[model samples]
Target: MPAARPPGGVTVRRLTARDARALTTLPPAMSWIHRTWGGPEALARSGCAWAAFQGDRIVAVACTYFLGTTYEDVACVTVPDPRLQYLALDCVDALCADMAARGHTPSWTCSTSNRPGRLLAWTAGFRPEREYAHYAVGAPAATGRAAAG
Candidate 1:
């Protein structure tokens, strides 16, 4: 698929192992990639990462994880620059197209609290598949009981 051409001179391209350092510059919200995928090195090796470049700096990134023979889970993060916000959707679009060509369906799991992410997913033509609650198990509460209880 052809890359997205955002106005204002931004360029989008696939990210590789060489771009690991750039991944580090992403905001904290995107740090989950490091924790879940074993940092930029693993992400680079996944052969499914893409980014938007503004000159020598990385302004946005999108990646996919193959869940099975038929589905790929997509995620993305972008700099807070409003002028460049659209870049995230563009990157995802490119990734989705690439996935389709390879016979894998692209799917997105978005946080309801993340309005921008929801918007981006919708703009990229993703619709709600199903709804499920997400829970995090953290340190014990002061009473030493399960947080849910």
Candidate 2:
């Protein structure tokens, strides 16, 4: 990485198990990352995760496990607070760059209905690899407001 300073005195670092707690505070839906793979155990397994911290606080996070020139299973979640959006993008940039450096062409995916997800993926340089109709059953009724469960 370059010595150039990013805005808001933000800095990026590899996320460790230590970050799991703080990451879990981001919002319930956002907590899935920590719940699933943000802890030390997952990091000890097949993949790596990274975060952007503002001083001692985690502002953004990204994790990529599956690796391939064509696709990878990636999870990206940021603090829901809008003030943190820039930091999220910064973390994403670093993640993509690092993956490219490692000889893998990283790609991302989102459900066709996830508008913001699609927007974020496109802005981050991932193109549509494929799309398919998905079916769901026994799920709660969809609501524009996030589900509380």
Model 1 C-alpha lDDT per residue in residues 107-136, reported as the tens digit of each score: 988777888778888888899878778997
In angstroms, the error of model 2 at 141 is 17
Off by over 4 Å in 1: 1-4, 136-149
Candidate 2 colliding pairs: none
lDDT of 2 by residue, 1-149 (tens): 22344556677777765665556556666666655544435652433677877777667788785655665556687767765565656667777877777777777767898987787777777789799887778967867656543
lDDT, candidate 2, residue 6? 51
TM-score of 1: 0.80
RMSD of each: 5.1, 6.4
Leading candidate by lDDT = 1
Worst 10 residues of 2 by lDDT: 38-47
